[model samples]
Target: MLLLLASLAFVQYVRTSSSDQNPYLMTDYSRLHPVKVERVLQGEAEAQLIGLVKDAKAKGLKLSIAGQRHSQGGHTYYKDAVVVDMTSYNQVLSVDPEAKRIVVQAGATWEDVQKAVNPYGLSVKTMQSLNVFTIGGSISINAHGRDIRNGSLIKSVESFRLLTAGGDIIQVSRTENAELFPLALGGYGLFGIILDVTLILTEDEVYRESTVLMNLEEYSDYFQNEVLPNPDIRLHIARISVAEDSYFKEAFSKNYTVDRSLKLSDHNKLKSNDNWVAPGKLLFNINRSTDWGKNAQWNLQKHFFVEQSDKIVSRNNAMRAASAFMEYSQPGANDLLQEYFIPLPQFDAFVQRLGAIVKEEDMNLLNITIRYVNKDDEAVLSYAKQDMLALVCLFHAPLSKAGQQRMKQGVERIINEVIASEGSYYLPYIAYPTLEQFRNVYPGYEYFFAKKKDYDPDELFMNYFYEQYGG
Candidate 1:
C-alpha cells in the first residue's frame, strides 16, 4: 500500500488583516502550534477503506479522516496524527434520477456532485454558504443554510457507506444502523468515516431574491411575520447599526440602485439623511458593517433557474467568501447578538424580548438577520428545531480590546440568557464561550463524547477542541 501525504505546512502565514485567527476558519492554519500529520490513504472503496483501516491499526497509528477541512472546530486537522486525506477519492459514483437520488464519494465537495447532475435538471435542496466543504464534513457538523424550509444538508441523505472503527463496511440509513444515522448527522466524524453517500435531489426551480433594510423597532415583526413564513424567500438577513448616522444619507442617495427589480423585492429600507441619521453613524452602527446603504444599488432578480450548474457556481462563490471572510457573524440591534431558536409558537415573544435585550443593553442595533429553517432531526446539537432560527450578530468596531471584551462579555451574558430560555448558540463562529457554556449549548454532548470514544478510543485524532471539551 502506498502512503500519500500532502504537507499543509506551506499555507501557514500571518495574515494581519484577516478576521479569525483560527486555522479552522481557513483551509490552512497558521497560528495554532504547527503539528505535522503523516497524511496517508488516498482513495478506496469499502473493501479498500477497510484494508487501510486495518493497516493503520497494525501500525499502531490512530487514524483520522480529512475532508475539505472547512469546519471551524478543530476536528478536521491535527498536529501529529495519521490523517486519511479523502480529496483524492473525489468521484460521483452514480446518479439515479428515476429514484431522485445521487451517490457520491465522501471526499467530493458539493460543487463536485452538483455540477455532475446539472444536465439532469436537478439541484440540492439545501447547502451552507460555501461549496468547498465536503459532503462528509458538512454531514459531520450537520450544517444548514439560513433557509427555514431547508434544514441541515444531511437531511437529503438517503443512505451512507460507513467505515467503522472495527474496520467494517456498513450501510446505514433511516432503517439500517438507524440510530447511528441521525446520530452521525452532526456526529463530527467520531463514530466512523463516511465512504460514500446517497442523497435525494430536488427538481430544478427558479428563486426570487432581495435584501431590504428595515428599522430596528420593526426588526422582530419583519423576521417572524415576513421572513420566517416564506420558503420561496431563499436568503434573508438583517444588519444592525452600531454607530450613529453611520448609515450616511448621502451615501444611500449615491449607492442605492435596484439593478434587476423584478428578480428581487422592491423593498429598500433606508433612513434618509433624516433626523434619525447622525454623524459617527458609519463607525458605530451595525448597518455600517455591510454598508448596504453605502452600495448605490442592490441586485434583484426573479425567475432565475436554480439549475445544478447554477447552484454549483453560487456555492463556489460561497466558498471563496468563506475563505476570504474576516471573522464576523451578522450583527444585531443591541450592540450584541441575542440569537434564539424559539419554537414557532414562541416566535412572537422571542422577537419582543430580542428587541428588549438590545434596548436594555443600550446596544444600537441596525439590522437583525432573519433565517428560516425547516424543523430537522439531523444533529442532536443542531439549532434546527420546531421554530425559525434567528441569529442576531451585534457588531461594534474600531474594535478596542476593552470594547471587544465588553461586547464579548455581553455576548456571553446574552448566550447564557438565551440558553436559560432554551436556545442554543451557533457553535461554529463562537470564540469566547467556556466548556460549561458549550455543555449547556449542546445537551446531547454526552452522546457525542461516547460516539467519539467508540470510534477513536485511542484519542489519536486530537485537537484543541478535544482538550477543551475532554471529548
Candidate 2:
C-alpha cells in the first residue's frame, strides 16, 4: 500500500514537472530538436489551408505539416517555417458500410475512424497498433501493425486529396493523378499537404487471444510453419525479452485468432479510456529505470498475457491497444522509437547481431516488438521490399548533446548490421543513420527526392527529414 502511494506521487511529480513553457519553439515526441517557428496555425477549413499555402509560396516561406507531432524525427516542423497543426481539421468525411470504405480528413485519428464506423461493424484494415495517430501521419510514415493479413498501411489507402505547393488541391490515387499516388502516400510530407484520405475498411471480427512462449531462434520457423499458414489468425504481435536474464534470447508470440462461435456484439465495445494509466505508467517507469525492473516487467508480461489467453476481443478493440502506459515526460530524458525491417530469411541472424551490438554499445533499450509486414513495393519509399519482420524498438534516450551523439553512433552500428542482412531501417525516427546507409537501404531515394523537386519546385514543403537526406 505504501509502495503504491509512493508510485502515484512520483507519477504526479513527473506530470507536473514535464509541462512545456515555450510557445514559439516546436519539437516532436523525442523533444530533441526544439526549433523556433514563425507561427503554428490550426488547420480548419480547406479554403484557409489553400490560402496559407499560397501566401507561403508568395512570401518565399517554407511550410511544414504537423499532426500530433509524434514523429521522433523533425518530420513535422522546421526553423522559422509555418507549422500547420492538422488535428483541428479532423473530421470523418464519410463512411460507406456497403462499400467497405471510409473517407476522412487527414487530421482525423484512427480512433475517430473506428468510432465513426464501429456502429456499422467496420474497422480499419491496417494502422499502427495504437489508434492515437492521425491518418495523415500514419500514411506519411506508411505505418503497419499487428494484422499480418492486410499488409502495410498503403495497401489499404484508396485515395487522398493533396494540397500542392502550387496551391491546388488535387485527388491522388491509383487512377486520378495516378503518377503522384505512390510518391505522395509514403512520400514523408515532402510531396505536399495530405488534406484528406480515403481508406478501405474491413469487417469487425471477434478474436480469441492466444500466446506461445518460445526461444528467440525458434520464432522464424514458428511464424512460417504455424502463424502464416493459419488462416484463422487475423492479427499477430510478438515481444522479445530485454531483461538482463533472457535479453533477446526469449520471446513470446501473441495471436488473435478468429472465433466464429463468439458473437461480435459481446466483444465489440471500444476501449475509450485508459483507466489504469497511472499504475501502468509507474510500472513502465520502473521497467525503464533498472535491470531488476526489466526482469520484473518481462516476467509480469508473460504472466499477464498467459492469464489473458483465450480472451475474446473485437478487432476494433484490439486495435486500440494500451499506449498511455508508455508515455514518458521526464525533463532531460525521453523515450524514442526506431524500427528495422528484416527479410524473414534473415530474422534470426539479424537479431543475433543486433543483440551483440546493443550489449557492446550499452544502449538503453526498453522494448522490442516484432510484427510481420508482407512484401509491399507499392509505395516508392516502402520499407518492405520482401516479406519481412519489423523490429519496433523503443529506447530511453537523453536530450544532452553528448548523449545524442552516443545514441547516433550506436544506432549507426545497428543499421550497418541491418543493411548487411538485407534489412531496412524505418525513416520516421531520428536521422541517426548516415545518408550512405539510408541510400543503401532505400535505393529508390534518389528518384523519390527528384519527384519531390518535380512536384514542389519552389521547395515550399520543408522539414528536417528533407534537409537531412533530400540534398
Candidate 3:
C-alpha cells in the first residue's frame, strides 16, 4: 500500500529573488495543484511581513497568506501574489485555566494548543481530526469536529487580532468591531491575516467510546432520540459503508461519552501514530481500488470499534488526527475531497440521491463521514445557515488531465444535487462550480463581497477560490 505521511515539521524554503519560481509552485493537502506565485516569504519576521503587506498595498501588488498550507485548493495561494508563510510566528501567548481560555498566535497548531492547555486539565472544545492544522487556518475555515453541542470553532472563539489590507491591526470580537468578528472567523483569509486567536477550552474528561449499527433511514431519528438526549456524550460520528451490499444502506455510529466512573490520567495515552500507520494506509489504499478491501476494512474496524466499543480514554487522546489514511500526497493519484451541507430535513433525500449519483457516476467512492452542524449565522459566507449534516467525501482520482476533467463533471452533478435539496456545498474544496452556482447556493455572497470593499478597497487579499466564484 502507498503511504503519504502528513508532515508536521516546518517546511524549509529558500527565499531567493529568482524569476523561475513564478507560478510560485505551492500545493495544499490536495496535491492537485502546485501553484506559482511572484514571491513566497520563507524566513521573514512578523514585522517584516506586515511591512511587506504595506508595501504590497502601496505598489498595488497582490498579496496572500498561508499557515501550514493545509487548505485543499488555493484557499492559501493566489496567482502572481506574495504569499506570507505564517507558521514561523506561531507561539502560545497565554493560558487562563480558571477562565478555561487560552490565547495563542494564529499560526500555532491545535497540537500546540493541546500541549499548553492539557496541563490545566482542559481540552479544545472542537478541532479537526488531526492536530497538524494551524489555528489560524482552522478559524479561517471555521472548522468543526465531533462535538455537536458546541457547533464550530466560532462558538469557542472569544476574539482575535486581524491585520487588514492597509496593515492595520484591529481587535475583533462579538462586541467592539463586532462586524469584523464573523468575517474574520470564517472569512477564508480574504478579509485579513489573523494575528492571534483566543479560544474557550473544555475539561479533559474521560470518555468511553462505543459504536452502534443502524440503517441509513434511522440515522437522524436515532441521533435526535438517543444521541442528543444524553449530556455525557461529547463526540459523535458515523461511517457509511462502501461495500457492494450495504453501500450507504448501513452505517456504524461511534459515540464518545464522558465516564464519571473514571478520571483522566496525567498522561497522553495515544499510541504512536507509527503503530497504526501500516494498517491504516493499507485499508485506505485498498478501499480506493477494491470493494473486497473496502468491506474488509469495515469489518476489521467493526470488530475493534463495535464488538467491544467500551474502551475508556482521555478526551485529549480521543481527538488526535494522526490516521495515516488521512495523510499527505499520493504520487500518481489525488485524494479529492468534497463536502456538502444538507438541511436536516433534506438529509434522507440528499444521501439517497448522492448514493445514486455515486452508482451512476461509478465514482471511486471510498468513505462518507457524517457530522452535525448548527446554524452559523455569524459568518458572512456561512455554509451552516441552519442545522445540517456535513458529508465529507474522500476518494482517489488519477493524477492526469483527463482525471481532473472527469472530476469537474462529476462534482457538478453533486453541487446540483445539494442545491436541489435546498443545501449548499462547502467552499475551500474543488473549484468546480461556476459563479452562478456559487451565488445560488450562497445568496449572501454579494453582500459579503460588497462589505469587503469597505475594508479592502483595492481587493488585496485574493485567492483561487474568490477568483473562481467571487463575482
Candidate 4:
C-alpha cells in the first residue's frame, strides 16, 4: 500500500510540473485550445465598456465576453479578439427583502449574492451547484442545479440590461423588449453583454440531509413517485457509481428535507473557503489514475454521505458546495464536463447504453451526477425541452491533438445515444458534437443565428462557439 501511494504521488508531481505557464496565450478551463488575443481590457465602468465596443467596431475587430472563464468551450474567448474581462465589474446593487428580489451586476458571482442576502434570510432560487460562477455566465448558459422547484436559471431572472452591438443599452424582460428576452438568455454572449440582472429570491430555510442507496433502474421512478410529490424536500441530487465493480449499477440520492425544528441562523453563516482541498485533490488525482482508485472513491463517497444523513444545513450553506478540490492544472491532461438532458422516461435506457459505450471506448469517466430540471422552452436554444434528468459527466483526457480526436469521437458516440433517447446536451462544454448533431438536438439553430444577424448585422459580438455553429 505504501509503495502504491508513493507511486501515485510521484505521477501527480510529474504531471503538475508540466502545467501551462504561458501568460500571453489565453485558454478556458479545458486548456485544449490556446490562442493569442489582441488585448484583454478590464470592464470597470459602463461608459468604458460601451466605448470599448465602439472602438472594436471602428477597428473592425471582434469582441468576446469573459467572466471567470469557466466555460470549457471557446465561448468566453476568440483568437485575436479583444477579451472583455468582467470579473472586476462585480457589484451588488440592491436587495429588497419585502419583494424577495435582488439586483446585481453581471460579473457578480452567486457567492456575492449569497453574502448580500443571507442576512435577510433569502437565497437564490436557482443556480449551479457551486457558487463560484458569475451571474452573466450562468444566465448566458441558462444553468440549473439541485433545486427542483424553480426550474432553470432563466425562470429566476426578472430582467437585465444588455449592451447591444450598436452601443445601445436596452432593458430586456418578458414584458419589455420581449423579442430579445428569449434570444439573449441562452444566446452564449452572442446577442450582447449582460450588464446587470434583477433576480427573484426565495426564503432561506434549514434542512436535514438524507441519503438513499438504490440501483440505477429505480432512480427515475423513485424521484417521480417519492421526491417530486413532497413539498418539504427542496434540493436533491444523486450520483451513479463509475467504479469498475459497480459501474453505472449502484446509485444513491441525497435529499434535503425542510427541518423547521432547526434554526436557520445557526447554520446560515457562510463558508469563506473550501476545507481539506489539498487532501481532497490528492485523493481525486488518484481516482483519475487507476481502477483501484475508482473503487476506493466510490466506497468513500458512499460512506461519507451516508454517515452525514440527518445533518442540518441552511440553503445558502448547501448551495456553497466545495469546488476547490476539483481544480486540475496538469499540463498534458485535464478534466472536462459534459452534460446530457434525458427525458425522465428514457433515463434507464440512456444509462444502459451510456455504460456500454464508455466501457467499449475505454473512456476515463470520473463521475456522473444526476439532477432534475423542469420543462423550460423559454430560451431560444433551451436544453430542457421537457422535464428531464441531467447526467453531468466528468472525464479526464489528454490535451494532445491525437488524444482530442479520440475523445471527440467517443463524445460524438454518446451524443448519438442522447439524440436517439429524445434528449438534448448542454452547450457550455466542448464542441465535440458535430454541427449536424447540434442542429438535430437544437432545431432552433437557424432562427437563433438569423436573429443574431438581425440584431448585430456586422457580427460585432463573436466567439469560437458562434464561429463553429452560427453558420
Candidate 5:
C-alpha cells in the first residue's frame, strides 16, 4: 500500500542538478537542445514537481522530459525548452509478488526493476533491445525487444502515475482513466509526462533458447505463425547476412524447445564458426562480404537454459548470443533503412519484391531483419496491430562507397514501396522519408496533438518531434 517517496524532495534535487552541469550540455538523447530549466528531479516527488511544472506553464515555455535518452527517434530531445531530467528519480516504489505487480518511478531503469523483481521470482512480460533504458521511457515509446510472443513493453504496464499539462497529478490504468490509458500507451509521450509505472510481471522459468541460420524462403512461415503464438517464448531476432552470391539469415530465440526434425548437426556447425559474433561488432565486418545477392542463409542460435525465478540475471547476454554491438547512426549517411510492418498476407510478396529490387539494382543488401508481434490494444499510431510484423532492417555501411550508394537508393525505393503498401516505418530507425511520408505513417498525429493540447496547453513539454509533427 505504500507509494514511492513523495515528490517534494525531487524538485529540490532537480533545482540543484541543473546547476551541477551546464544546461548547454543537457540532451534528451537524440535531438540536442540548448535550454534553461530549473533542475532534473529524482525520487518520489519527481512525479509531482509542481514548481517546475508551474514555472514552465507560467512562462508558456515548452518542457521536455527524458529518462535514459535511449530512443532513436527525435521523441525525447528539445531545443530552447525547459528539460526535466528524470534520471535522479530512479527507485522501486513497491512490489506485490502475490498480485504480480511492481511499481517503479519514471526514472528507474529496466536494470533497477529487474533486480527488484528478481527476488519475487518475477520479471517483466517484455523489455527493449537493451536494459539500460528507463521504464517510463519504454512505456512512452511502447518499446519491445526480440520477443514475438508479447507485443511491445506497453502491454505489461498495469498502471502509471502521470502529470498532465494542467499540472494535475493522476494515476492511470485500464480500469481507471480507461480511454486515456491506452491512448497514452503508445501515444509517444503526447498525453503527458510519465511519473511512474506499475507493470505486471511473469513468474520466472527456465529459458530454453537456440539460434538458427536459415534462408528467407526457409523460415518466413515459422516466424509469422509458430514463434509468435507461444507466450512463453522470448526474443525472436532475424538478421540478413550479406555474403557473396548467397545471403544467409541469423535467427535467435529464447526459452524454446529444440525441434528434433531440424538438422542439429548443421545448426551446430554454423554456431561453432566465428560467424556468430555480437551484433555491434558485426557492423565493422558487414561490409567485408563479397557477393551481395538476395539469396538466403540462416544461422540459428538457441539457448535451452533454466534459472531460478528470483535471481538477478543479465538480459543482454540472454537477448543475443553474439558480442557485436553498434552505436546510433551519425547525422547524414547517404544510405537509409526503411522498415515496414505490413499484414501477414503481404509479407511473402513484400520479401519477394525486396529480393527482386536487390537483384535488379545490384544493391548490396546489408542485413534484413524481420520481427513478429502480436496484435495490441488500439492506438491510432500503434504499429503492432498487424497479426504479424516483419521488420526489414537493411544495413548500408556508409563508411564504404558501394555501401553508401546501395543504402541510399535502397532506402528511397523501399520507402516508396512501404508507402504504396500502406505500411508505416518505425520511428526509432527512420533516417529517410519526407514529411509527407511521415504524415502518411502517422495520420493520427493530429489526434495526438489534440490530446496534448488538453493536457499541456502551454506546451510546457516539447521535443523535436513535437515541433515537427505535434502541430
Candidate 6:
C-alpha cells in the first residue's frame, strides 16, 4: 500500500515537472514537449529552401522542419527554431510505371503519390502503413510497414535532393554523395532539408487476406516456420490482445498473400471493399481515454477482425492508412508511443519480461502491434541492428504529474529490457529515454554527428530529439 502511494506520488511529480518544463500547450500528438518557434514558413517550390536557410542564418536562428507532425517526440520542432511546414508544398513530380520509379516533392503525402501512380498499376515499395504521412517525413525517419520483403524506406529509396544548411542543393544516392544518404534517411531532420526524393515502386500485387490465432510462446516458431517461408505473402502484421481474458498469451496474426486467381486488370475492376476510416478512427479515439475502451477494441478485433478468410485487395488498398491517420486527442490526457526492436531469438523472453513490467506497473497500455524487421545497417542510427521483432506500443496517460511519472518509469523499464536483449529502441517517439540510452542503442552517434557536421556545421537543422541526444 505504501509503495503504491509512492508510485502515484512520483507520477504526479513527473507530470508537474513536464508541465513546468513545457511552457506552451501546442505540441504534436504526445503533447509531452511543447516548444515555441521563431516563425513558420511554407512554400510550393524548391527555391523556398534557399531563402529559408539564408533568412535563418541572417537572423542567427535555428531551423526545424515539420510535415504532418505525427511523430510523438518533440522531433517536429525545437525551442526557438524556425519551423518549416512542408505540407502545403506537396506535389508528385514524376511517375514512371514501366520503370517502377517515382520522383516526388519532399512534402508529398503517400496518398498523393498513390493517386498519381495507382492508375499505372504501381505502388510504393515501402512506407509506413499510413498514407497521410509526407514522403520526406517517412524517408527522414526511415519508416517501415507491412511489406516485410521491402525492409525500411532506405531500401526502397533510389535517390533524393537535399538542401543543406548553407542553402546548397545536392543529390544523394548510394553511390553519389553516398555518405549523406544514410545520414539524412534517418537523421531526424538534423542534417538537411529534404527537397525531393526518388524512390522505388512496385507492381501492385493482388492479395488474399488471412489471420491465425496463436499463443505467445508459439509466435517465434510460427514466424519462422509459417510466416517467413511463404514467398507469396507480401504484407504481414500481428496483434497481441491486452484484455483480461487474453493478456499476453492470446494473439492473432494477419497476412496478405498474392491472390493467384486475380489478374492485375481484374483487381482494378473490383470495388473498394472498405475505407477503414470510420471503424479505425472510432476505435482509436476510444483507446485514448479508458480501459474499457481498450478491451472493447480487442474484443471487436478478436471476434470480427480475425475472421478474414479470403478477403482480397490490391497492394495499394492494403497499404492504405487505417488507425494511424486518426487525429484525435483528449484534454488533460496524452497518447504516448514507444517502440522497441527485440532480436528475433529473444522474442519470447522479451515478451515475458514486457508482460511483467506492464502488468506490475499497471501502465495504461492501449495498443501493441508487432512487425518483423530484417537486419538493416543502412541507417547510421539504425534501430534494427539484428533481425528483430518491432513491438510498437501506444499508451494513454493523464496530464496529472503522477500519470506522467508513471509513463516515464514504464518507458525506462521497457528500454532497459530492450538493451539487455541486445536490441534497440526507436528514436522517433517519446523523450523519456536518457541521453545515455540513446548512445547505448545507437553507438554510431559520434560518427553520425561528425558526418552531420560536414553538411550542417552551423547546427542549423534541429529538433528537440536531436538537441537532446546530438550532444
The top-ranked prediction according to lDDT is 4
> Taking the tens digit of each residue's C-alpha lDDT, what string does model 1 give over 1-471?
011111111111122234433433322321223356666456656667777777777777666666865444456555555667788787999998877789988889877866776556566766664566788877777776543455767777888988887788889998898878877677666677788889888754333334344444555566667765654554443443333343311110000111232321122111111221122222122234444532311111111211111231221122222322122322221122334555545555555565556556654454344455666656666776555555545344323455556655666666666666676666544245777887887777887778677766866445445666755
Residue 370: error of model 1 in Å? 3.5
Q: Candidates sorted by TM-score, descending order?
A: 2, 4, 3, 6, 5, 1
Candidate 5 clash total? 48
Indicate whether candidate 4 or candidate 6 has the larger TM-score: 4
Candidate 4 residue-wise lDDT, 173-203, digit = tens: 9999998898889888999899999999999
**Pick by TM-score: which candidate is best?**
2
Per-residue alpha-carbon lDDT of candidate 3 for residues 1-471, written as tens digits (9 for 90 to 100): 233321211110111112222243766666666767788875245687678889998888887779887677688887788887788779999999999999998888888998898778899998987788899999998998888888878989999988889888888999979998887787888898888899999888888889998898999788888988898888888888887868888888889988787767644454344465645665666677788978887787778778988877788877884665445343567678889998878899889988888888777877889988878878888889888888989867776788877777788898998889998887877787767788998888887788787888898998877777663
Q: Can you list the residue pairs that collide in candidate 3?
A: 23-36, 23-37, 24-36, 24-37, 129-321, 130-321
The stretch of ten residues in a row with the least summed lDDT in candidate 3 is 8-17
lDDT (0 to 1) per candidate: 0.55, 0.90, 0.80, 0.91, 0.59, 0.81
On the 0 to 100 scale, the lDDT of residue 402 in model 2 is 90
Candidate 2 RMSD to the correct structure = 1.5
Task: Give the worst 10-residue stretch by lDDT in candidate 5.
Answer: 299-308
Of the pair 2 and 5, which is ahead by lDDT? 2
**Model 1: CA > 4 A from native:** 1-33, 38-48, 227-369, 392-411, 459-463
Question: How far does residue 288 in candidate 1 sit from its true spot (Å)?
Answer: 11
What lDDT is obtained when candidate 4 is compared to the true structure? 0.91
| Candidate 4 wrong stretches, greater than 4 Å | 1-18
The segments of candidate 2 whose C-alpha lies over 4 angstroms from its true place after superposition are 2-16, 19-23
- Writing each residue's lDDT as its tens digit, candidate 6 over 70-104 gives 88788888778878899987888888878899999
Clashes in model 4: which pairs? none
- In model 3, what lDDT does residue 233 have? 85
Superposed by TM-score, candidate 6 places the C-alpha of residue 180 at a distance from the truth, in angstroms, of 0.5
Output the worst ten-in-a-row residue range by lDDT, candidate 2. Answer: 15-24
